[model samples]
Target chain A: MANVRLSSIKKSFGKTDVLHGISLDVASGEFISLLGASGCGKTTLLRIVAGLESVTAGGVEIEGVDVTRLPPEKRDIAMMFQSYALLPHLSVSENVRFPLRMRGIGSREEQAEKVAAALETVQLDHLADRRPRQLSGGQQQRVALARAIVSRPKVLLLDEPLSNLDARLREDMQVELIEIHQRLGLTTIFVTHDQEEALSLSDRIVLLNGGKIEQEGTPAEIYSQPETGFASNFIGSANLLPAEIIDGETGPVAKFSDGQTLQLALEVSARGPVTIALRQEDLSLDANGDGPKAKVRTRVFLGARNRYVLGLAGEPLRALTANDVEFSAGQSVGLSIDPQRIRVLPR
Target chain B: MNDRTESLLLALPGLLLLVLAFFMPIGQMLILSVSGPDGVTLSHFVRFLSDPFYLGILWRTVRLSLVITIICAAIGFPLAYIMARVGPKLRLWLVVMVILPLMTSVVVRTFGWMVLLSRSGMIPEMLRDMGLVGRSFALMQTEAAIVIGMVQVLLPFMTLSILGVITRIDGRLEEAARTMGCSFLQSFRTVVLPLALPGIVAGSLLCFTLSASSFVTPNLLGGTRIQVLAASIYKSVTQTPDWPFAAAQAVILFAGILLVLVPYIKMTGPKDG
Candidate 1:
């Protein structure tokens, strides 16, 4: 296991820049996630670290060695593509042993042993002799993971490897990934666009937007305290409302453009124009309460929870409620949220 | 009518044409092969097989065809892989270049080879100037000339067949191989080659059969000294005026192709397992 440090990496295609100048330092054996929406260059950044793509400028150092100009084969890294990219001609055992065979990691007997251990780790030992084409999607994904870990490279790069599986399989693989990381302690860099996957997997989440770092922190730190409206909206998908904060006789109160006033947390000392972001699950909906009155525009049934879209103070708001709390469309309801849960951002 | 019957009815004319045009000639040749001057006999078959001269010609034909097939495969595989990996526009250009020789008539192409391989040809002259070969050297009227001409004529069939298969191979497999620690060429050899075996086998079969049966290029480039089965069969009928002997040779050629093909088809045949 080793640390990966990327300093001022930038990539561009012709006149269009995909990644702006960016820098990041991942400590030894840390699981760092580069999370963003599509076209945010998170995959590009991961590919650069894997040596699959060249940096337009700046350096990539793996285990304190400058490997910026090295080819993927020369770099001590293994990447798992989202497509699985298993060799169709080889059996599952051979696929898992490929990195060992290519890198000349061990003798034939040792390679076979490693392959067996890797397959057992992924719970695919029985299907060792079967070709990749014979395996199902989830089985193929496990084989890919086995192949990536067989070499025990300095760094493990996964490019949205779980995106192809179904939701249940994704969850299972996520837990498996965590266990594997714990057992092997390989410095892993996972690139994904799913915020929830990033939140659940990474020791540190580096949120990216428009090819630049928007925020970087632990999942709880980033989620609980988003610094910008974009970060707030992207992370929790919170509803942003333009507002003005002023010092009141008490602590501070935020006034929306529609004239609804809500108390702010004492920690928020900023007064003047600002934006308030309220998470959907943080809002509590009641039919007979004295909180901010809002009209329910739509309700989405989400198994155990129902998400209600409401129009509050002339702006749209979303709140998650228990499935038992039934509210018809166009019905006016009161919405309440803890002042601590509200995130206020400067305009 | 039902769809199956209707489709068969629509295909009747082509099937009838094939039976009349293809099967009828083969049937006639089979009849003539068994016929003799006095009565039906196996004298022609026994005579051809027993003679060292005729046996040498048969041996030469088989040897040359094998060499041509191997050469075509050697060059066609990497060429097809390049075509499959390149951008679409370049791929179109590559396809045109591969099949360009097939567009020209065989007689013209053979003459072009004759010019290039002759004693005074550009190739021999350049080699002599470079002191690589003696001044009396010539590539024409030799087995080397025949193999070269046949490979050039049949390379397109070999390459395009493989290209069609290689393009359908998912590119992600190579990328995955790289991450698995394979270099670019290693991935091509290990991953792309095995996946493209069906195409290679198919192309080899076609190249072998076509080179075995070919006449014009081999006749012109190889001259009268080096004779293949097709040229020998042609001489028996046209030059020697021996129709029965010619028919016997033709039957042998037909049987030889089928003899080589049955095992090949079995190797690639659909698996009931």
Candidate 2:
């Protein structure tokens, strides 16, 4: 395993700048995730690291080698494409042996052994002789994974590899990925838009938005303490309400545009107009609780929990509550949340 | 009518056209090839097979067709690949350029080749000036002339066939290969070429069949002495007026093309099925 350093990496498609001088240093054996929505340049950043895309003006140093101008084949890295991109002409065993064969990793016998071992790792040894088209989607994905790890390159880059799998398979693959990472200890850079996947898999999450790093932190730190409104909103789908922080009788209260007031932490330094991010799961819905009142607009049944979309001060607010709670449309419910959970940000 | 009968009715016009226009002539040719004054005989087939001159013409046709097909594939595969990879607008222009010869009359195109390939023509004169050949060098009335003329006419068929398949291949496969430690050329060889085999095979079949059966280009370019099977067949029908022998040669040519095609079809057909 080796550390990957991308210094001041800038990329542009003609005049439209996609990545605006982003720099990152990943530790050896660390699993770093580049997380963002579609068209947010997360995939582009991952491609740049993989040497699949040329950097406009930056240096890419893998294991301090400064391979900025090197082509992808010259770089000691393996990438699993989002589509799996398995060579359809090759059988599963041949597909898994491709990187080792191309990289000249070992003798023929050694390559075959490594291929068998990699297939075993993904629990796909029985299907080694079958072509990629003969395999199921999940099985194809596993073959892709086996091919990627077979050579054991310095870095493994996965571009939303689990996105195509169904929910159960994705979860299973995610667990398998964690186990593989733990066992192999390969320095991996995973690009994904799914927040939960990034949070669950990565040692560090680098959140990207509009070609720039929005936030970078541990999953818990990012989840519990998102620094920006975008961060809070993106991470936990928090309800961002435009409000004013003013002195109240009890503590600092967030006064909404329509004069609805919600309690904030007493240590909140922002005085005037600010946007407060309230996580959906952090808020409680009640009929007559002593808190800010909101009219329930819609209720969605989500098995164990019910998500309520409420209107507070002429703005949509979402809150997750227990399945036992039942609130109908136009029902006025008290929205109670811990003052500490309110993340106050500058508007 | 029932659904099956209604569908058959819908297809009746095409079936009638196929029977009247296509199969009728072939049936007539087969009948004429075996017909004799006394009875059905193998005399025509025996006469053509026994004669080395007629056999040489057959061999020349098959050999030249193989050569032309190989050359077309050698040039067409890369051309198709470039056309497939380029922008759609550019690809359209390239395709039009490749197919422009086909838009003209085959006789006219062959005459164009004749002009450039004759003794004092532009190509021969240039080669003579460059000292690449003897003083009396001429490209006209040679197998080389026939190949050059035929390749120009048949390249579009080969190129477009391969282009249809190559364009459908996911470009990500090449990129994935590159990431898996393949160089650019290695990626093309290992990934693109193998996936494009069906198109290449299809194009080869078309090129081979067309070159083998083509009479106008070879007759015009290769002249009377260097005879291909099609030219000899034409000579037999028109000059000597030996209808049965001409039909026999035609059947032989048809059989040879089918002989080459069957194995190829079998190779590619089952994998897809």
Candidate 3:
């Protein structure tokens, strides 16, 4: 494992800039995720790290060696594509042994041993003789994983490798990934738009937005303390409600467009117009209590829980509450949340 | 109608056309190849096989065709790869350029090669000016002239076949190969070449058969001194007016092509099957 440092990497496609000067330093053996939606250039950043793409401006350093001009093969890195990208002509074992064969890692006998070990790691030893086309989608992905880690390169790059798998397989693969990362401790950069995958897998998440680094932190840190309006809305999909904050008796009061007022945390220093981010689970439905008056638009039953979509102050707000507390559509319900749970951001 | 009978009915016209337009003439040719004045005889086949002149013509035909096919494959593969990877507009232009020779008359194309390849022409004169060849070196009416003319005529078949296959190959596979520590050429050799084997096989088969039996270009370019089996067959029918002997030479050419193809097909055919 080795440290990967990307210094103010800027990439432009002809004229439109894809990645604005973004600098990130990843320590050795750390799992970092570049998380963003489609067209957000997260995959581009990963490709840049893998040397599959050229940087328009910044420098890329690995293990204190500047490799900005090097090709992917010259760089000691392995990448797993989202499409699996297995060679259909080769058998599973041969596919896994490709990097070793290309790099001339060891003698033929040693390469065979490593191939066997990799196939076993993916629990695909029995299918070693089978071609890539003979395997299922999940099995092919496992073979790709085996092929990537077979040579044990200095850094590993994954471009949404789990996005293609079904939900159940994705979870299983996520667990497997965590176990493997723990065992091998390879410095890995994983690019994915799935928030849960990044939160569950990475030591740190670098959230990308419009080709720039929007937020970067540990899962809990970024999840619990989102400073920007975009961050709060993107992560956990927090509801952003436009309101004007004024000094109240105990704390700041947020006055909604419908003249509904809700108390904010005492530590909230913003005293002007701001957007307050309220988590779906934080907002509670009250029948008689004095809170923001919200009209119950719809209730979606999600087995153990009910998602109540409510219209509060001419804006849609969702509440995730227990199935036991039932609310019908068209009912006027009071929306309640703790004063401290309100996160105020500039409008 | 059931699926099988309906399918057969739909294929009936093509089957009838193949038998009438293709197979029946081949049958007539086969009968003519063995016919003598008295009755069915092996005399024509025997005379041709015993004569060293006819054997030399056959040998030269096989050798020149093989060279032309190999050269076409070597040039076609890289050209097809470039055409496959280029932008669509440029790829269309390259396709048009590769196929433009086929669109013209074969006699016209051969005459075009003849102009540039003659002793006093641009190619030989340029080579002499550059001191690449002796003053006595001449290109006209040679085996090489026939090969060059045939290669230009047959290259499109090889290139177009390979391009169709390469176009369908996922671009990501090469990228994956690169990440697996393969250089660009290594990736091409290991990943792209193996996958494109079917196309190469198809293209080589086409180039071999077409170059082997082609009459106009080889006859005009090589002239009478250096003659292939087809040119020899043309001479037998037209000059000597020996219809049976010409048919016999044609049969030999057909059999020889099959002889080369059968072993090649067996070598590259499906392993398990």
Tens-digit per-residue lDDT, A139-219, candidate 1: 999999999999998999999999999999999999999999999999999999899999999999999999999999999
DockQ of prediction 1: 0.65
- For model 1, state the Cα shift of residue A290 in Å: 3.0
Off by over 4 Å in 2: none
> Residue A321 CA error for candidate 1 (Å)?
1.0
TM-score for each model? 0.95, 0.98, 0.97
Q: Which ten residues in a row have the lowest lDDT in candidate 1 chain A?
A: A1-10
- In candidate 3, which residue ranges exceed 4 Å CA deviation? B1-6, B264-273
TM-score of 3: 0.97
**lDDT (C-alpha) at residue B234 in model 3:** 91
Alpha carbon lDDT of residue B58, candidate 3? 90
Comparing 1 and 2 on DockQ, the stronger one: 2
Per-residue CA lDDT of model 2 for B167-242, tens digit only, reads: 9999999999999999999999999999999999999999999999999999999999999999898899999999
Over 4 Å off, model 1: A248-250, B271-273
